[model samples]
Target: MAVLETPGAAGEPEIEVQIRGLMLDPVTNMPIVVLKEVGSDVVLPIWVGVFEANAIALELEKTETPRPMTHDLLRNLAKGLNATVRKVVVSDLRADTFFASIWMEQGGETVVIDARPSDAIALALRWDCPIYVSSKVMRHTRQNNAETAANVGADDLKRWLENLNEDDTGQYKM
Candidate 1:
């Protein structure tokens, strides 16, 4: 089970979210991993590189590769070392870059490893663990969306991101 710390402020709870889908950004043509808060309308989109996106897509579709992929190898290594992946957290956003932490347990000891949001998410899927996002990051995303909306002279970006449905995430190609 995933354990999250209580927020210090009201309306600032650590949100448990799921991978809504993965799609390509129309403008930048970058891969975006869309995460939606459980039982809520809040959404967070993190743009990622092509290779990382490919790793996520492969797992998302449950495609089997003849050889173990990097994420697969990591999962195997953890198991071999008697480590269990507890959870993954999208812990922070800084200068438009998002950060994540991979929480693991080994021999009654807890370990936290810093990672990119994309990598952490990929590992989370492999481990079948819960994913979380800090309320502060969600607030920052909303603020950034507003700023982007204003600069774009329309709320298209925000609207488009918030309104993405499962069908909108077509097969992500390399």
Candidate 2:
């Protein structure tokens, strides 16, 4: 299920988004996690480090490793502690960087942990939790990579998804 939050009385609602794909940025040669809104054409591409992208991609592709990865360990730890990850929020974009928070609940108490968007996204995928992007951040992206989704048809998106290859994940070994 998807979760959206308004930070305060005047805050904009967070919009739920899903991972579209992980691919290497042609110009930067860095990995990027592409996210798309569930019922809209809005898309956000967050450039991430190579290894973290691999972690997200592995979960997206349902590839199991012989040993638990870092995200796996964190998920298992939360389970061991009886903490449920309610949602992962990509809450802000400042100084050319994105920020996120992981909302968790345990023993009738709720907690929010500051996290990098990449790491929080990986854990969210593993836990089968929803991912949200603040409207504020969405506004910022509208001037950047948002056109990728705004003008594409469903068939185009499907073809793009179908063409994703292992090589597109960059040089990281999963």
Candidate 3:
């Protein structure tokens, strides 16, 4: 999976990938973040927990929930502290496990808070913050690319595309 970062992520992280879609697993009842390369046609799938997935999905759909969720609370807390989530860094990938940090700015100082990639991403979505994964993490993800492709066969992709019998609109509609 590519680290998230928009123009605001950090010093302008290259926008190599864009979130293509979010899929819910039947068994886990959780959501998967789908990313597609900017030009080339490649997709990365990252599974996420239900609570965090809901946070990201809500942002994509531009839907406001009845109340602020945990992520929202974190965002407010950041603001109250005069801090801003500058960017989220996806820093590590080992044994298929990923790690991350939330970079915040306050009092002209930058702070990096350790976090799980999934949680950082969820919070990033809620705070309208940019996401950044290190180049090293991207390289590691590349190492697993082949295995990822083999697991998701062409037949599987066809089946998935067929299931999405709707327009590829801008809205995430997750």
Model 1 scores worst on lDDT over the 10 consecutive residues at 1-10
Candidate achieving the largest lDDT: 1
Clashes of each: 0, 0, 1
- Sequence-dependent TM-score of model 2: 0.79
> For model 3, what is the alpha-carbon lDDT of residue 76?
85
Ranking by TM-score: 1, 2, 3
What TM-score fits each model? 0.89, 0.79, 0.72
* Model 3 steric clash pairs: 4-131
lDDT for each residue of candidate 2 in 121-155, tens digit (9 for 90 to 100): 99999999988988778777775443554566444
Q: State the local distance difference test value for candidate 1.
A: 0.84
What TM-score quantifies how close candidate 1 is to the native fold? 0.89
The local lDDT score (0 to 100) that residue 42 gets in candidate 3 is: 49
Clashing pairs in 2: none
Q: What is the C-alpha lDDT of each candidate?
A: 0.84, 0.80, 0.65
Ranking by lDDT: 1, 2, 3
- Give residue 76's error in model 2 in angstroms: 0.8
Window of ten residues with lowest summed lDDT in model 3: 161-170
